[model samples]
Target: MSSISRPSAAASAHAETIRFEAADGHPLEGTLTTGPGHGPLALISAATAVKRGFYQKFAESLVTEHGFRAALTYDYRGTGGSVSQDFNPRHISMADWGMKDFPAALARLELVAPGHRVVGVGQSYGGQALGLGNVSERFERYLMVATISGYWRNLGGGFKLYALMNLVANPVAFLVGHVPSGMGLGSGLPGGVFSDWTRWCNRPDYFFSEEPRFDAKNLFASVRTPILAIGATDDPWGTPAAREAIMRHFTNAPVETRWLDPQEAGGPIGHLDFFRSRFRETLWPEAIGWLKGEAQA
Candidate 1:
């Protein structure tokens, strides 16, 4: 076996917990897993409502098995470890998470692993947020897993879930101060975060048509980084059409899109399972090779 190849849980103790300030001055919590040797720095961005911990095992594997110098995972404002303050009703938005929080995470990673090349690995909404963020151009390459625009029509069976968010969860979030934890959205979300997601998913134009807060076309047109977008054939939330919708926004990026069927992944690998530890034997190594520029779509 290679020197760096090891089980994910075996290297958990080596991870270092740290704090970094966001562009907006919000203190964000993160964990940095240092590899056995120096290599590229990886910033693993989590999906919506997903905590930094959700990516811990994946981050550990990247450092322990893939030869990355370090892998950083952080929580967005108002979620997970970043929610150290009283946020009965935090006034944050999805755009803030994309434009502000992600950039801050990038800056933090750059500081933590100076002189090392940076590779961005964004899962689902994590990938969407990176494209919309300001500092994405700083990365050498991007590996976006299950990334897609929140267009309701292209969601296949996921439209029901989006509809419920728009009609039920959103109202409860505004009234109850947070998205209900029992709803199983990885983690409970702030009212504003949930509402903003609903507003974007409910609209046909998604974030592209929104004004004042963002100019999606102009924002993504500047992206020239090589992109590798991986999607699942069985993921209703990130269907092929949905992925295309989001990829269309990155007008300048040379994007390579790949679809993996559950059978090829050894089981029913849906949107969430793409990053699950179980796939470490399958997709994980493929992802690492792709990020290293050792493989192609």
Candidate 2:
């Protein structure tokens, strides 16, 4: 546990820890950032293996710096403060994260701050979950950052190694009962999570056809909510084709696509860099401004 390790919020001036349950009645934890006289709510959905603390700074920014009335950052079951049971004993997959936890977070946010427009900020796997389990309608606006169909064939250059890593990694996960941290992935993952991730990455349709458990109706076509889908040039996995392959499913949403260049963005904007605090000046303005309807063309 680093400085960001799960804190009980201590009832900070602008943030508070809130405990909620996933759709499965699984216990979960989150932090809510809010202030007086705010507008919409921002929900920060984290990427696979990444914890809610990873998004805490961004969540605070939504309320502190941006116009959002409140922001909620939470961990899916078996991750962060929500991990009540050991990983080896139970099966947990993206479907659990998407179909169950994401909606529960949204419902909790609604309870905490009712009647406000809900905005979603989904990073990588976070973006995929919105369409996976029919939570798109809950968000009046959505932003997808580095969210892509992780099919290795769609990736280019060094990113093609994602598949190789999966080959090497999955076996190790099976042996160890978990996906050890590092090896390019940010955090240690439950064996089931890494299993689902690799299995989906193997398919052209990604999660759409990779798993029978993901049989929920494809809701991407049904989402009328406005979307901002951003691709980073330096991100190997989030290639233009990869991003397009997944986002093209949102037929009904007014999708605005943008590619961020490291030169213009002031630094290398990798897949994980978008949420990092360093880019708060150069990159966040356009992304956050768009939601506030204050973005420049």
Give lDDT per model, in order.
0.80, 0.77
Q: Give me the displacement of residue 251 in model 1, in angstroms.
A: 0.6
Model 2 clash count equals 0
Give candidate 2's TM-score. Answer: 0.89
Global lDDT for candidate 1? 0.80
Question: Over 4 Å off in model 1, which ranges?
Answer: 1-8, 11-13, 86-88
**Residue range 206-282, candidate 1, lDDT tens digits:** 88888876887888888888999999988868887888888998888999988998997898878878888888898
lDDT of 2 by residue, 57-139 (tens): 77766666775788888888777777766444138776788888889889988875777788899998888878875867778
Q: TM-score of the candidate numbered 1?
A: 0.92
Give the deviation of candidate 2 from the true structure as CA RMSD.
3.5
* Residue ranges of candidate 2 with Cα displaced over 4 Å: 1-13, 86-90, 157-164, 210-212
TM-scores for candidates 1 onward, in order:
0.92, 0.89
